[model samples]
Target chain A: MNKKGIIFIVFLILLVLHQDFWNWDNANLVFGFMPVGLFYHACYSLIAALFWGIVMKVAWPTELEEWAEADDSREGG
Target chain B: MSTVIVIAIYLGLLLALALFSKTLFRGTSKDYFVASHSIGPFMLLMSVFGTTMTAFALVGSTGKAFERGIGTYGLMASSSGLIHAACFLLIGIKIWAIGKRYGYVTQIQYFRARFETKAFGYLLFPILVLLVIPYLLIGIIGAGKTIAGVTGAKITPKGTIPGVFPEWTDNGAIPPWFTGLVISAVVLTYIFAGGSRAAAWANTFQTLVFMVMGILAFYLISDRLGGLGAAIEQAKESHKVRTLSSGGEVGTSQLTFLSYMFIPLSVGMFPHLFQHWLTAKSAKSFKLTVVAHPICIAIVWVPCVLIGVWATGIFPSGIPSGAILAKTVGVLVKDPIIVGLVTAGILAAIMSSLDSQFLCLGTMFTNDIVLHNSKKEYTDKQILSMARGFIIAIVIVTYIAALLLYERSVFDLAIWCFSGFAALTPLILAALYWKRATKVGAYSCVIAVFISWITFFTMSGFGGEYFVFGGIVPAAIMWFIGAGAMIIGSLMSRPPSEKTLAKFF
Candidate 1:
């Protein structure tokens, strides 16, 4: 799959994992303090953040940057 | 007294920073409204995140997590983390690109120009203002409530803190209205002098303050209750940890939780956010904002949710949801200076957004309504003065409106405001991507959004959470209503003109 397609699939997976129904009534705590569901989401947020970093690096629209820079150069000239 | 003094000192510092930013103002409407598109990446990240994460993130979520449970994190904060970043990537970047190319400063300006309809501006300006009033109130009311919450406590007899002034604190605290007035004035002073540049500068400073303060509050409060483990242990027995369906006091039904995914889409249509996006110096400026937004939400939210759930054990009863966070920070952290600084952080989170909101309202009124509809031309100075004047006027008016709404929860008020904006996301989504989107289709979408929102908000009795059934949020329903209206209306009408289409595409 293309980069955008992979990003979209990862986005979908994150959305589904966001629900966390499996941990809903687990009554277990991570690190003896954090609830399972809460811990799951805290990890999820980090992963989502890292995923977005990948998107920024790979799937980013570099064309927009080129256009903005070209526009600036034209004005400068 | 020391607490109030510390808060006063913090506000004074913020005012100084914003005033310093005013020195850099280039003296044009463009400069006043969008910093002449000169903001860099880190500042953009701070301003955008700061504007989006308001008292609604801290004050609203802490209180909400108190009433709800740990599931509150999943329902709103986690979902917001992912969804808000998606919005920046999907909507914000596109808007910034188009805004830069077309010199648009307000959402209405973009919509009006894009749809080739004068009526588009007229139609959207009121709805945007109507929705933003509640959002602005979220900041104002939250600041007032938070300061009052932190200040109303004094360590004494009966094992609780009394209000600073016993005779006039309404049996134990400062009133929200007084704090609201002061916060409004503080925000107004900076925005009046410096405009959007001031907001960005102040938000950058305040975001740093609040994040540091948030972690400090988490650490201090946890130490006071023992450790993080001990604190959660204290509340482990309460419904604060369990789902509502699983014998918990709070409702974390699977369906209700899923319904909340629709709420974060509200960012896709925030006017203040759109204005913030336009301040970016380049398309690359959005990279930091898009990538860091989720973790920022997590950083702010996790502690707030944990503290709130912990509050259930710390104070078993007799605390309003809004006051829980403030009261917790104030009571547990006995030192006056610490309490004052922590509360300052809360106010910082709130005021950071208020300046942007007030500026956007001014931008909409001046650019979308007055300048666009009028025949005569005005100089840059005239436009700047008018915007400043209108923002002051809105501050007073919104402050008064806030007085009438002091009884409502920040969480509930914010949800309604967010729902109204979320219902309109279909308009921008279609306008940006759909070639077949016509002016008639835009009107239909707005009409559908307005009607459904009014009905839902009214049926919600103006201040309560009202689900369509027992499980579904009204915003979840209105999204469909809006998208359906847009598609059907567009299909039934002629496509956008080739000229308009070519300009956008």
Candidate 2:
């Protein structure tokens, strides 16, 4: 599979794993402050950010690049 | 009094920003409606971020976390960080290219062109208006509740503020109607003066204020509760499950927990977002929004949700969920200036979203309905005037509705509104990505949404954990039916024109 296809699969995996409600064994605190479940999601958010940034770099369409250049010219950029 | 003064000053600053943008405004309807499609990456990031972070994120999430626990972050914020960016990359940039190419300014305008049917535009206009009114109410009601909570005056032992103005409010907060009017007026002045350009500029400023102040409120409130560790312990003692489920235990049923995920998808169909997307200077402007948006969501939402959870332990007897944030600030943060600043920050989040929404609705009215149907050609000045006039009318109607229906929890009302929009997401996805998606399919999707939305809304008694098949949320049911209708109806009907398909694909 191509890199874009791999990124899509990774996103799917992340989505599936995000349903962590059944992780009841994690009723512990992470730092004496954060709940295990809450801490898990906080980590998930950062990972989500990193993965989406990669998707943008890998999957951004060439057509959109041409479109942006076209618009730039129209705006006298 | 200090809170009211601080909020007033914030409004003044917003209006000043609007006036400043007006000086820079080119005298054209293009600048008014879509900011002449000149917004840059950073400004686009701020505007889109501001427009999405509604009162729901601050007041509603905090209130919900107090009730549900930390799972509130997982249920919405964590997924939102991913889903929102995905939508921007997949949907936003594509539609923006189409819109910029076609000179379309509203979602309805794009649909009307893509489907080659004017009837669909008429059908969509009212539904969009109806959905947006509830959204407007979210901000208006939240502002009212926040202001009332902070400035309603302290309750004496008799449950009344011992003042001559005893009849002013039942809770001794500023009356909801008065608060609604003031908020409506402030948002209206900015939007009216500078249009979308003003809104974009003002939102960038308000977004910064609220984000900074949200962190401050979180830190101060946590410190007041004897640090974050003590706050968690207090919560675990008083409300063991205060992390983030729906009123469920930490082990929220897998199905029920998964359904909340559908709510974040509503952004895919948000008309205001469509208008904001069109304001991009180029497709490149979207990169910042897609990359930085998740982090921004984390910054704003984590603190609000944590504060709400902490409040559960601190106010053990229970506080109204809507008033949790304001009450925490009012009670725990003794410094009057700090209270005012924090309240202003909360209001900034609420109002930032409102201005964009108000401007988008106005743009739709003028572009999709008024101009699309007009037999005579209207001048640029006339078009601008119509959009502005319609916005004032909408602000009045929404303000009155807010005063009448300000009694529900902000969290519940916002969910019902999001559900209605979420059910419509599949239709937009098909419109953008599927060449076979027919006009009939879009119609069926709309019908499915209205039917399922009304049935579930009525069954749920307006709002609350109304599930189907023993676990799925009402929103999930509506979404499935809507998606099914879109796919089936498209297959059964004639495909969209070769012309339309070629244009979009």
Candidate 3:
């Protein structure tokens, strides 16, 4: 499934469980006792951390060759 | 008999672990201070969480909740947790990135390098030392109090020297000096032996002990209150569910919310928390730790809040609102074994936070300020020795401060420490995110925060006796002014060199 589809399913599940569209006080319904607010906060932090990790993983310089090239460019400048 | 033996074994195991880690201590500067920057995710998670939890969470947070009702949870838990997560997301990643790039071991190094001003570093270093020392004293004193209270050991009253160490008392008793001495000895011994690495490893064990105890306390307390449903019912009956309740007029709630927001944001900028971020093995480790932190928070804090609420219903009279819950727990739990375990758990929370704070403050003073400005080059061994020396000095000074100043609440000490960082964080964030931010602006921002926080804190002390407004109002105003000065100063001044901008951005 697409990302949008996954998000939609999660939202629907939360809505059905909570029975209160977006109200914090009434949104205590994930599993038996845990609240949606709690889950939301946890998931938000995890996703943000994961996204940043991906960025750093992809962008960080690799290998001695790359370091030498970057150093040469700096010297030229 | 089994319970007492279990408790004894646990303490022995902790001491053994401290000793075992000591063998790994090569006395090199890096190994002593930051574990040679080889800490893993599990070590990182435990150390950071353990240090942040503190004795304040165990005693002060619950006591405050009992006094102020459910709003205290919002102030201390949900808002604080969310802001901490945000800090990791926004500023923590950047701190790790820059720290690695510059090979910066301490937060002060970052400040010194970024501003390109050793003078600025000199000024900022003392502020950290001054604000953080009182907090260390609170940690030391809190542990002492918990040890005495739990062990049922006799204590001398404040300012009184007993003829000898008195026997255990069942009823009301005096405070203990021996408690302080014992706690100090344990902390100083390991920290002196192994430095930051020892503290970090011990913190991992302590964090586990604290989490289990907190969970157990919740279960026991909830059971005593009949169940979770019954506890909520009692809390509601006691009028403890008022999250938006105001102590005074209309603006009080708004002011309280603003203070909560600002205070939590300051957590990221705290010197010790910064040290934790800088020591991560990889950016990936840092990210994982941040993501996992909320689970730790939930486990640690939710139980404390529940216990606070339960205490409200169980003990409605006799005790004052501020210390009602703690006093109630003292009365209800007559089992010596359980009480001892509870007390140790509380001390674990306090010591875990205190040792981390002491190490961070010492490193900043020794490594960042003193060593940076010295003309003579020193080896890593020399630097490590200086760092350990500073830790001892900080502990001695803070102990003296605690003895001299006797009436400040732990919460007050905590917030005062936070105000210093709260004033500095905005400018730090701007410098990281905004390419146009200049050195001139950064310097002015520091100056503005320094002058404003000091002035407002002083004025509030004088004004609190008569003025209608809370001190937080003036503090909020000062933070904004400082932030504004930084932005405006940058706009008017020469932009930073392209190379400098590229290094950070």
Cα-based TM-score, every candidate: 0.95, 0.93, 0.81
List, residue by residue over B382-418, the lDDT tens digit for candidate 1.
9999899899899999999888877766457778888
Instruction: Show model 3 residue runs off by greater than 4 Å.
Output: A1-77, B1-12, B151-175, B236-240, B243-255, B317-325, B407-410, B462-475
- Prediction 3 TM-score vs. true: 0.81
> TM-scores for chain B, in order?
0.95, 0.94, 0.88
Worst 10 residues of 1 chain B by lDDT: B239-248
Task: Give the runs in model 2 whose Cα sits over 4 Å from its true position.
Answer: A68-77, B156-173, B237-251, B408-411
- State the TM-score for model 2: 0.93
Residue A32 in candidate 1, Cα distance off native in Å: 1.5
lDDT: the better of candidates 1 and 3: 1
User: Which candidate number maximizes TM-score?
Assistant: 1
Clashing pairs in 3: B55-B350, B155-B174, B155-B175
Can you tell me the CAPRI class of model 2? Answer: acceptable
TM-score of 1: 0.95
Which candidate leads the pack in lDDT? 1
Note the residue pairs that clash in candidate 1: B154-B161, B154-B162
lDDT by residue for model 3 over B222-250, one digit each (tens)? Answer: 67667676765666322343333344311
